[model samples]
Target: MLRLFSVLIAAGLFLACLTGYVLENYTVQQRTYGGAGEHLRGAQPPYPAGGMDNIFWFLQVSDIHISRFVDPQRAPDFQKFCTETIDVIKPEIVLVTGDLTDAKERNRIGSRQYEIEWQTYQTILKKSKVLEKTKWIDIKGNHDTFNIPSLESVNNYYSSAIAHLCGHLHTLGGFMPVLHSRHERGTLELELADWMDNRRYRVLVFDHDLFSFVDLKFDKWPVVVITNPKSALYSSPAHEPLGKIKHSTHIRVLAFSPAQVTSVLIKIDGVTMGSAVHIKGPLHTLPWRAKDYSTGMHYIEVRAQDKAGRTTIIGHKFTMEEVRLLPFDIMASFILRSSHYMTLRVIFILVLLANILVIIAFRYLTRPQLKESPGFFALVNFSFHVFSKTNILYYPVLLFTCYIAVGPWFIGEIVDGHFGACFVFGVVVDGHFLEGSLTFLIGILQLTFFNIPLICYLCWCLLLRCRGAYFRSHIKYTGWSCSVPMHISMLGLLGWQVYACYLLQKTYGTAAFFLSPVRTWSVILALVLVYKAWNLNNSAIRTFKADMKNCPYS
Candidate 1:
């Protein structure tokens, strides 16, 4: 029974090592700009239980252009939108892409005008009480910054208000802060709405100035209109392609302005699908369906107008596909796009190897009388125990580590306004592709310098278990088989993980990286391991002393 137990330990460790390696490699190789890249083309799942049939709706509003130069009625206009118009639509979430405020004038740098504009923006939201009803996220635009020439006229505007934009965002609720590395840039993730199954969609948002106005439409308050049919990427004047949808697929559209916007109109191939039902809510989706239309290239267009008679129009050609209800495909699309076909085969082989190791360790091998005769298998058996059951916190620590390794993807889901699905993992490891891979490099450095060394040190402790007699004559060794050094090493790893969490917090402008449910538990797990190790080591020392008193040699 003792031998069988040892074999099981060995098998478990071997399996864990293999699993860890496979997951790490898959995550690294599949990292993409937004996530899963082009694999998102057809990964939409079915709607949730309460999802609207044949229609998915979301609101898009952009370029409020809140400026100090605007008339006094501007504040009231924003208020009416949030309290009256937006409250009526009641969308699932609202996307305020960029240009929340206009700061093109260089003279406004030190005039306190910039502060007032932001104050109005905040006050409007507060008075409207819309944030609680809907998820509203705003990014940065060129006009929101100081003296951005390309978007504005190229003039020598002596302004020092470059950093003020982020300050306003920090004060406003729902917007993510600007991230700084060598330069300040704004970033957010947008997950495409999925159909009923597990289709994953994510888009990365950057806060920076554009080189030309040609990209403004898509870059502004962007809207993705998913059509049922798949067709060539048609160049729309303003909007970009969201994804491919089936006949019954749900689509979300964000309206740029609620106050200036009188009503949002949706159409399929020149026929009105539905006028988005407006309500007294912060966010609402205009649900529409396409049952009468046959499968072919169909045009999906949305237009929103304000009280001033200004209108924004965007349309795209969509190819409708035959609907087939299947299981989740977003994750499967990622796996298929990752091109790691060997994962299943490798897992199978690893399982078989583990079983063989168990049989050999328990059914055949025994602790040999001679030290050298026991050889590498004995060392492996001992090493397995080092990872499997050295400290009382072994399982807890291991589990915690695994959770953080994959927690970022789920967090991404929250940012993208989706729940009950995790399309990707390893947020820190994958990093933002546009950010010059800074976060990615940090992840690699942590693994190489911290995790690898910690594992090596733990494995080295197996040597201590080889046999006291083998080293007894060399230096008059003591029979103290305690895990003091191993305990210290684990403590070091725990300390380093805490530091890593801080690094992420500094970069992201929020402690959310470490404070996440997965990472918070990691800290507690490490603390428990530290305490347990100290107690076990003390007990081992006491037991060793008692054995010495009864020794024949004594």
Candidate 2:
């Protein structure tokens, strides 16, 4: 009855979580830039046409990773970037796309946000006066999310923004730009490289209703953005009306250079049109008939050369027709974003189902029989009787396993100056509870992988010391049948332990294997159990041989 109840509970939880995932991901549509009401109402009015008055420029800097413990110079360098580079560019807005601080400790394994790092970041902004010069927008990266219980928490020092920009992977490397499906819905997802090692930042220009951007290195000159007849690859009807692009008169460009304004050359289909004239601050305009190339797709290349002998070329594919992203691109982005959540859900469901099956199978195998047979039934009965006899050592080991399953197995500085528990249910940081599927999975793993094997080993040892003749006869009849499953379970548990140790070593260095009490104790207990099981196995084998010799059937 208890086993049946456990199976039902597992099934219930699985269904509940499955329903929750479906409702959260599918039924409830995520709000876009146009807001939830707009989405529910379907396509609303298209955005206004592009114009010179709508032109503006901004700076996007990501992965600042200011660290006071590891590299002390990081904070100073960031401050210098803000004061020297930001002041000169004088962008209307500065978008900081996360990783405002390196949350790791000196060892780099422990993840906890330090207040000093946040204070240093604030001090830099104030000292540089960048906040007063431009609209500073900052969002939390994965690093910033670490140890953060809630957005309202005092430990969360990030300045909230409308869109979330992450910088956990440092850089996509060769992947460069990974545009998302959200772009189709008028939300641009741009990821910038790290500023810690690579002094990279993006200069994004909003020309009319079009968006054009270019990634620039520190001190790199002639930041160019082609503004007119926007890139067809990025143009979206949700943000801008595609029908109005054909009425554009001149090909406009925004070029920012450290040196004196130089010549801006415009090329269409590899043919140079003419030199663009400087209209205003960083704005260059070249007259071009939009209808001339309105029939098919065309490429626009803008090459800007400064007096400092530095040249930069940027190209974009433009078309007067409607822009549609490839179907594969949209699918790929959706998959990449939701892959982790999907994987966790699948694994959680599988674990629950497997446990239910195992319980049902065990109950069926151990059920009372009207006529007992000397095959698998006798083996099951023999195993059950042996395990039913509990020993004094079992109590302590069972208590230890329970504690490990539920109690604080791993405790560290989860929040600034707040040491919290990282147990089976979840992590508790500064009195806030953060529970997830991963935490529950770990608890299930502890119960199945660690507790079950240890309990079985305890029962096996007790069985070897049993002095009843009937029990000895049953053991002889069962032979290796009962022992094989226990041995297999123990071997599987040991394998899991070794794999876990390797994972810990890989992630947090070799010191973590020994430093983590849960892992260290698990290894020690497994080794001890293996040694005891071996000795008991040999004793059982001797006793079986002796009983067989004395039996009349032999």
- Candidate 2 per-residue lDDT, tens place, 1-554, comes to 79669979999998999778645543324232322112221223322232346677889888888887776677888898788778667799888888888888676756777888889999999999998999989887877877676688777777667766654455556353443343335555555677877777888876654677777788777778887767665555565545545666678888887686689999999999999988777888887777798666798998999998889988988776444432225333443445554465556455545544443344345433323223444433444444332233433454565565457655555555566667655777677887655666665676667766665665454434432323234456336776577667777787887777666554445445565556656778767654553344434444333433422321
Runs of candidate 1 exceeding 4 Å displacement: 1-329, 332-365, 368-378, 382-459, 462-491, 494-554
Candidate 1 CA-lDDT value: 0.41
- TM for every model, in the order presented, reads 0.28, 0.64
Q: Which lDDT tens digits does candidate 1 get at residues 283-310?
A: 2245545444445457777776656666
Please list the C-alpha lDDT of all candidates, in the order they appear: 0.41, 0.64
Candidate 2 lands at a TM-score of 0.64
